[model samples]
Target: MSEDVFAALEESQQQSPESVLERLIETLTAQKNYHRLFDALLMQQKHAMGLEVLQPTTFDNVPDERKKEFEEAYIEAARKVGNLFLDEKMYSDAWLYFQTIQEPERVSEALSKINPRTVPEDKVEGLIQVCAYEGANPEKGFEIMLQSNGICNTITVFDQMNAQLKPESRKKIAQLLVDQLYTDLVQSLQYHVQQKMPIAPPADNLRELIAGRDWMFEGGSYHIDVSHLNSVVRFARLLSEDDPHLAKVIELCEYGSRLDQQFQYPGESPFEDFYPAHLHFFKALVGEENDRNLAIGYFEKKLEMEPDEDDKQMIAYVLIDLLTRLKMNERAIELAETYLSQFEDPNTFSFTSLCRQTNHLDVLQKVARGKGDLVTFAGALLDAQNKPQPQES
Candidate 1:
């Protein structure tokens, strides 16, 4: 077969380019060499366009009139090769082709179906990259990392995630971590509780399991890794209020709060009482009526008592963001008007944006005038002037 292919290839040099391409395609297709077939198809398109086929060139070099045709050929060839790779479960290779055509969804769907546990060791890293970092199936990728590499490595990966990751993907991964840590803590705590008490405690809820169990923390004993607890509870802040995992996360914070003083590491600013602060924040986010008010009062006190300007600003921003998330925009606007007036950097936290959200351009103008920021003051004046007047009956 090799000799015949070589003979045909040698013979094709004497034939027309079109005939040569046809023979190449037929031969490569017969051998199931789709990768080479992709190159051959691209070569054919380049030949038709009267461009040099020996070297690679971007679509930018293609004439305006021919660009669409060239792109169509590229997309069709990519889809053919990409799907062939996908059908063979060659996900990483498939991603290469599909990504060029901006069709990650096809690869993402295929990746989602894969059981990471069953994947070969040699292939695991490649699949992880395609799934996790490539934005194909981050949740599945995170699961693979957690299952295969264990919690420590998974935490490292989460910590090292760059800003390029979508907030939604980050949230999903965070929720997974929360669920895993919560389950681990519950199981460990249940075992400890069973050793001491004859009656088995509630199996699922962390809060119920740990309730009135002061003896559980005797001699600085902890059910789960305190560091893991701290990391996961912090990650839980990224979760949406509506996420079912928020309740579990809040429960985790409750567990953390009971840890000995040495384990209760102080956090920055408003979360100085790390577990307690986060517990209240998560409670408020969970939208229990009493807890919501308590959480608000908790942060408000932090803002009031904090002497450091920077720390106070951070607390105010946290409170303002929480209020906004809870749809207490009036409260958010009031806090912004009070505490955020001095913060001029929009990139940090946009006082202007909050003003816009509340439709209080007058406040923006006032704040702008106070700061002597002519650009913002003038813009606010123009915006107010352009408002559609209310019609008098």
Candidate 2:
């Protein structure tokens, strides 16, 4: 039957190949031989147009009108063959044709039709890839992999897909994964709250999920987001508290602080949104039994960089007190003198007294003498002397 259609093409050189192809198509249509019809039409169409048959790359050279006409017909034929292959339980063959047509839905449907338990481990990865590829319903792919293999398998595929995607696509996929992680975290926390239990850290993949994403993409540069830093800090703190892993807690806090310090929170100094995270991290750093020096170092760094008036004073006070208690007198005096020179009085009635109490007399005397203002320093000293220290309980 196929031979008869090609036989007529020899009848005339004057007749266009399109004309001959059209007649062959009519014959195949009349006989309901759609399978051979698609091939004959494709070959004649490509041959007349000087394109390589079955070479999808040559599709670009074809005019839009012609491309659309054949794309529709070819996709339909591929879908028919794909569905037939699926019906015959030839999932791999069905997947190939369905994927070639770039119909994600049908490809997903074909994969879903297979008995997952029977799918070979090696082939399952490919099926997972097909599902997760761009426009290939990654969320559905994730579900399928999770159901068939496990969370570990799904995560492995996701990690691979994330690595393969370009920046823009990777960013998009990263956000999707982040949203998914956030959703899961929230749901789990909500369940814990309802059960009157403490909220626990999420699966370890939460870290992997966020590992590749830059918190901010501005002007083609990647920047960390303080909120993401805070989330990590909180995660670390929660785990540390639950398990009392001081070393890991310190590591997380230090990392969070470093990231926080590196990123200006997109607005004013001493970002209001970041204050809680920063405060919590500081507290966690100090809260550990043996890392007091780490806490002092963090506070000193904060004082060195802090620009906000109140924040600087607050940090100076903490740093000065820590230094004094640790008997690091040289650094303590240096910090006090610096603070006295640049620090704006925080408008609290007792801020001078607080400074006087936290700092040693020698440091205050040196600052006062250096400023050539004995009178003001004298008043501060008098106030400090007059204010009785709190009695020990």
Candidate 3:
């Protein structure tokens, strides 16, 4: 068969996952078709392959005649196509071929064959998809994709895995993605820095600081919870290149550090209030704030660069929260008035936090309807915000 004919036939097979699995099985069994099937299957996924079986017994209980027909079509397609090759570098082409195979169930059955084996994901991309979506062994799949040389393919797999993760798992995987990419990304950024791109730190202590544990480093059984958030933030930075939406997330959660203050003064800076993981993340992103102005400047640059709407508001809101804490009530009020037409209700965490900090009643009274979290908590934060200097009060 010509490539075009095989291509057309492959398209037809892809529409039915069950049929594809059966065909693959039949091809695997047949002497003449075996080679051809491997060719096509190998070309189908640059990593791993598996059938996404919705019903295992469907094939088992099929009438012999129907099973025979399905098997024959698959086997025939395999024989006619002859030996084809799938290269890891040629993932997109392989993706199209796999996309043409029909029957996810059939694909899943084929996958059942390989589940127990620790196979390299680069050899079977479809399995990664199945395992990720169909509840197969994802940890193994994640490792292979990360190690693959093909950057684009890795990104594709990452996106697929990211979509299916739970919230807690998302934070974990996002961290994993960041950890995996940070070195390369930092190297890339380092190059940009040498070439005069605006950058804060030269990838020096960053990698070394992150690399401490893989070997002899041990924190002992008395685990420090603060360090965990710091680790997550480091990973978040690495994961951000592909997920720009995090700029908004960072605005909301970036200030969420858990580091315990060491000194009696500086009266618990906002920077130290969240988590050490966040501090590491912020340091990587904005560098050390030698002074308060530098910290505010960092915030300014962030606000200017943020593309997401929610992110923009959060940035302004967090700043307002900071200013209110700093006794810069006038500035906090100014921002609330400016952003009122934009931030709106419901997403008023930042706004309320600001009003609470500033004690500017006129700015806060209009937003009084939300209650509890709105009034009580905000009022408490307001009172705390009103505390006199550490020595004076």
Candidate 4:
């Protein structure tokens, strides 16, 4: 039947191109062959434009008079074919068309509906690549990877994730890790405590689990994988202060601090003490009254003692960020004015943004004038002018 239609299409093409396209579309649509229909539509558009070949790179050479028409036709065909592929549960094939048309949200939405358990073993990795690494549905992708490939692989992938992944996406993955590790640690602790005592630990909280169980740490014993613990604690920094998992993360830090010194490795400045520093940092982030003061004093001392100018800058930013997070905007502005104002690049920390957020453009103006940065000085003046002024009572 297809051969007969193709034979007639060939004959019709010689007589009339429109007749050939109409016949081809009718036949492919009857057969539910939307993939081929997509190609056929593009072929018809290119034929109309007198182009012998149709490639994305060659689109620039398309006649200016008809470029919009050609692009619109291409987009329409891509959407039609991509939707058909999605309806057929052909996600990999659907991604090709939707991606070409810069419509990842369509593919992402479809991929999100898939249950990880029902995914074929052979197709798991490809789906993971599209959903997680390619930015389609990162949370779902990470979930699928964790459930299918296990925590080790998920952690490796999470660590390898570049800066292009949005902070919210990273935070979601971090929350998953914290939950997973928290569960594992609690189970392990419960079992161990059960072995020694007649009953299990009453509290599921990590801090409560090991409150007086020094014997649990005997001979350098640990409940969870120490490496996983370290990685998740580091990743948990990306989590927001209000995240419920933050409490578990701090508990993990406390557990890490109890480990033998051999397990305690150093980290970058401000976190050089590793788990202990993170415990204090996370505690301070959650507004723990004593830890807040301790964190402030600790970072202040580190900033004062650092000898290297570069290291000092890094430490100063950390202190400033901590101050800002604590809602001590005045102190943050002071630190920014003192340590960061001289630096023009705001990639790491924007002094201008800090000043603006605190409604202290006057401080920015002062810094800009001191540095002889006319652009910023002028910008501050303009922003100050735009701010709403109070009327006389």
Candidate 4 per-residue lDDT over residues 1-393, each given as its tens digit: 657877989988898887887788788877888878887778777877777644532467688898898899899989988898888877777888899999889988888788988888988988898788777789889989988998898999898883668878989999988998899999898888888895663678788988988998989988888889888998998887778888889889999999987887777787888998888788899966898999899888998998888888878887887788788998888888888886655445678888888899999999889879999999999999999999999
**How much is 291 displaced in model 2, in angstroms?**
29
**Model 2 lDDT, residue 184, Cα:** 50
lDDT for each of the candidates? Answer: 0.85, 0.53, 0.45, 0.84
Candidate 1 per-residue C-alpha lDDT over 1-393 given as tens digits, one digit per residue, 9 for 90 to 100:
668887887789788888888899888888878898898888888988998776433676688998898889999999998998898888888999998889899988888888867978887888788888877788888888988888988988888873556788889889889888988888898888788886864567787888877989889989888888888888888888888998888788788888898998888788889999998898898767898999999999989889998888889998998888898988888888887876656545788878877788998999889889999999999998998889999
Per-model TM-score versus the true fold: 0.87, 0.30, 0.30, 0.87
Q: Give model 3's clash tally.
A: 31
Over 78-168, each residue of candidate 3 has an lDDT whose tens digit, in order, gives 3233212122223223333343453223333334455423565455665555455444335434544555433345456555556455444
Off by over 4 Å in 2: 1-41, 44-68, 89-102, 113-123, 133-137, 147-150, 163-393
For model 4, state the Cα shift of residue 77 in Å.
1.6
Using alpha carbons, what is the TM-score of model 2? 0.30
Give each model's clash number. Answer: 0, 0, 31, 0
For model 4, how big is the CA root-mean-square deviation?
3.1
Expressed as tens digits, the lDDT of each residue in 1-393 for candidate 2 is: 567656776663358767766776677767755556657666775776667666543466677768887677667767776776667555556676677887646655555456556777777666666656643445555555665765444455556665454344443333333343344543543453344434533433223323333441224332233444344333332222223343433433333333434453432223233533345434534465445556566666676787777778666765665555555666766766666454544432233444565655545555667778877679767765876789999
What are the clashing pairs of model 1?
none
Least accurate 10 contiguous residues by lDDT in model 1:
52-61
State the number of backbone clashes in model 2.
0
Those runs of model 3 whose alpha carbons end farther than 4 Å from true positions after fitting are 1-117, 120-123, 134-140, 157-164, 182-281, 284-293, 301-393
